[model samples]
Target: MDLNSGAGSLDQFEGGDATVRGAAVVSTRLSQPTDEWFLEPLSEIRIGATEFSEPDQKLFSVTQFVTAAGRKFSVPYAVATRPARGRRLWRAKVPAAAASS
Candidate 1:
């Protein structure tokens, strides 16, 4: 468990016994082995971003995820899910002002 050491060279182990040198942060034998990681297909995609008109200040309720790729869609806040990195995709109740966008 010498984590301070650099990464291990798994490439040295070709196809034979590759399962023994699999990836695991903890020390434990896996009942079910797997060589692939991305097993599930992505359901929804995060193409772009959305911004509401300041949520109408006192008129609107909570923030929401209602826009993507410049198109508006009604997705409840609770059930909304999107993967965005840094400032690429942002969701907010307020209109996408220069500060946020």
Candidate 2:
């Protein structure tokens, strides 16, 4: 997915599997997959010092899913880094606070 050129750019990945590099403002609810869990986009994201006008990348992470009723689950998945291009960066831990937010 091609991210928009604004703060909400990263937020666009709320329900999708993608990893966005650069200086990202990680979501408070990043570990959750529920409708209520949303990500706030970053003001700027870049590789090195070069701004990403349009980036194609991916991220890999082990994610944990929790049901509204309190059941929990985990899975490994790859998210597009720049949206529709690039390879995935791997992640291991999903913060508990992030999951419940």
Candidate 3:
């Protein structure tokens, strides 16, 4: 995939159907099959990122995804060409009141 920072340039990450040879825990969920997906980092791996300047121009922060069977995939950048609903989905915080309930 190819990612544009919306700063006039693009960043790219490439991966394919191969076994991810490592012992790291990660999780991902797709709101829609083709629109977007969210990656959660349960280990010391780089799951996602966010650009502080153009905060509203991001979609998802995840740079890659590795399935439970070890298949790996990647995107072009940290952000997508759409509006993100939350700030850094990978690192998002839950309200204390909501958590306690």
Candidate lDDT (C-alpha), each: 0.28, 0.35, 0.36
lDDT of 2 by residue, 1-101 (tens): 32223422333444467754432222346476667654443332222111223254324332332333344332333342433322223223445998899
Model 1, span 1-101: residue lDDT tens: 32123112222233445433122233233454554322221112222233333453222111222232343222212211443221212233344685598
Count of backbone collisions within predicted model 1: 1
- Tell me the lDDT of model 1 at 75: 20
Cα TM-score of candidate 3: 0.20
Please tell me which model should have the higher lDDT, number 2 or number 3: 3
Per-candidate TM-scores read: 0.16, 0.20, 0.20
Q: Name the weakest run of 10 consecutive residues (lDDT summed) in model 2.
A: 43-52
Candidate 3 — which pairs collide?
none
For candidate 2, the lDDT comes to 0.35
Local error of candidate 1 at residue 19 (angstroms): 2.1
